[model samples]
Target: MRWFLTVLGVLFGITVFLFLDYALPSRQTVRITNTYNRLTDIGANAIFYASADAGTVQNAAGQRDVRFIDTVRPNGRPYVYRNEDTGWIWPPYFKYDSSNLHAQATDRKSTSANPEWVSVTSYGWRVSWLSIYPNAISIRSVAGPDVRPFNWPAVLILLVLGVLLFMLWRMWNQFHERSIEPAIRSADEAWDRIDAQADAARDRARGRVSRWWDWVRGR
Candidate 1:
């Protein structure tokens, strides 16, 4: 039971960590290479894209026009981002300015000879297999590709989660010590008393049998 609980806790912790890592906002400093719009099929990766009901533009036949911004990191690794309004759905960005962000990205576009650094704030993961791109929340010009903005929201959320887990651990320990252990000990004592009574009754039955055998031999 202890091993089972330990495994369960580890699995739960990993799931929560993954969920937060995906949902929390993160920033990447990169050079804006180009911006364009594409007619995409959300298809199997619909969950990664915005919901039709909560998006500014509804998808027809699981297809929509998604705005994309191409970028390159300082190390020259390419990254692509999707610009869309989250509307009133999950993550609560309440972003309704996809067109503005697209315009901003287009304006910031630069070439390899002269790079314009910009910080893009967004959430979600880019899984190439699923053809999913991170949805850009906002973007702004940065001093350089090395600039990294402090993530205060993510830090505070982690701290609060830590505190809550600690409290839950304390409560579990208290309940086990005060209730479970005492009940277990009482059950053991009761079983021992019952065993003692059973042994005495067996001994009495044997003595009665011996007396009847002695009477039959004397007759």
Candidate 2:
């Protein structure tokens, strides 16, 4: 049972970590290479995108014109981001400026020769197998390609979560120490008393049997 609980706890922790990692905003410094609109089906990857009522018109076949921004890192690795309005949905970016972000990405487009670097703030993972792209929340031009902007939002969120977990841990320890431990100890003591009574009764019964047998044998 202990091993089972340990495995269950580990799985729950991993699930929460992955959910936060996906929901939290992250920054990437890359050069915008191109921007375009594509009619995407969304298909099974609809969860990765915003809701249907997020101002983007969707057809009966679940197809919509999705704006995509193509970018490349300083090391020449390519990345793609979907420009979409999150509206008042999960992740709580409340972004309703997809067109503006797309325009900004288009204006920031640069070639390798000139290389205009920009920091694109987004959330989610780009899973190629699932045809998932990170949704870009905002964009801004940066000084250079090697610029690493500090993610203050992520740090503050983590700190708050840490404090909350610490408080919960303290409460649990107190409960275990005050309530659960005492109850368990009482149960153990009750069992010990019952065992002692049973042993004494058995010894008394055996002594009576021995005395009766000796009297019947005329000793």
Candidate 3:
């Protein structure tokens, strides 16, 4: 049972990690190569992309013009990202700044020869098999690709999770000390008192029986 519980805990932790990794924004230092939009019908992969703009209709077509940012990493590999407003659900970015971000990405476009580095803040994975790209949250020009952004979001998430776990631990300890342990101790004491009463009653009955036997033998 202990091993089973340990395995279950490990799986839960992994699931949480993957969910956060896909949901939280991370920084990527790359050079903007292009910016464009395309109209495509979202089928099964609709979940990978952000939802339709707020107050928009939903239908079987699932068709929308998705803005994209094309970038190349420092190692000259291409990275594509989708710029979309997350609306009021899902990842909860609450970001509705696709137009401004697209303009920024287009303005910062650089060629391989000049290679202007920029930090692209995004969340989600670029899984080719899944036909999904990370959603770019924001971007800014940087001096070079060697500079890495500090992951404040991850730090904050960890801090909040840590505090929650600590509180839970404290609550469990207090429950044992104040409730469970005391209840068990009271039960044990009650049982001991009951056993003493039974023994005393038996002794009194035996004394009465001996007195009756002695009077019969004397008469």
- Give each model's whole-structure lDDT: 0.88, 0.93, 0.88
Off-target runs (Cα >4 Å) in candidate 3 are 52-59, 183-219
Residue range 3-105, candidate 1, lDDT tens digits? 9999999999899888988988888999999899998886777788888766545456767888999999999999999998898889788999989999999
lDDT of 3 by residue, 1-219 (tens): 999999999999999989988887799999999999987567798888876554333456777678899999998789999988887888888888889999999999989888889999899999877778899999988889898988798678779989999999999999999999999999999999999999999999999999999999999
Residue 156 displacement in candidate 3 (angstroms): 2.2
For candidate 1, list the clashing residue pairs, or say none: none
Superposed model 2: Cα runs more than 4 Å off = 1-6, 53-57, 211-219
For residue 161, model 1's alpha carbon misses the true position, in angstroms, by 1.4
Q: Could you tell which candidate, 1 or 3, scores higher by TM-score? A: 1
- Could you estimate the TM-score for every candidate? 0.80, 0.87, 0.78
TM-score-better candidate, 1 vs 2: 2
Instruction: For each candidate in turn, give its C-alpha RMSD to the true structure in angstroms.
Output: 3.1, 2.4, 4.8
User: How does model 1 score by TM-score?
Assistant: 0.80
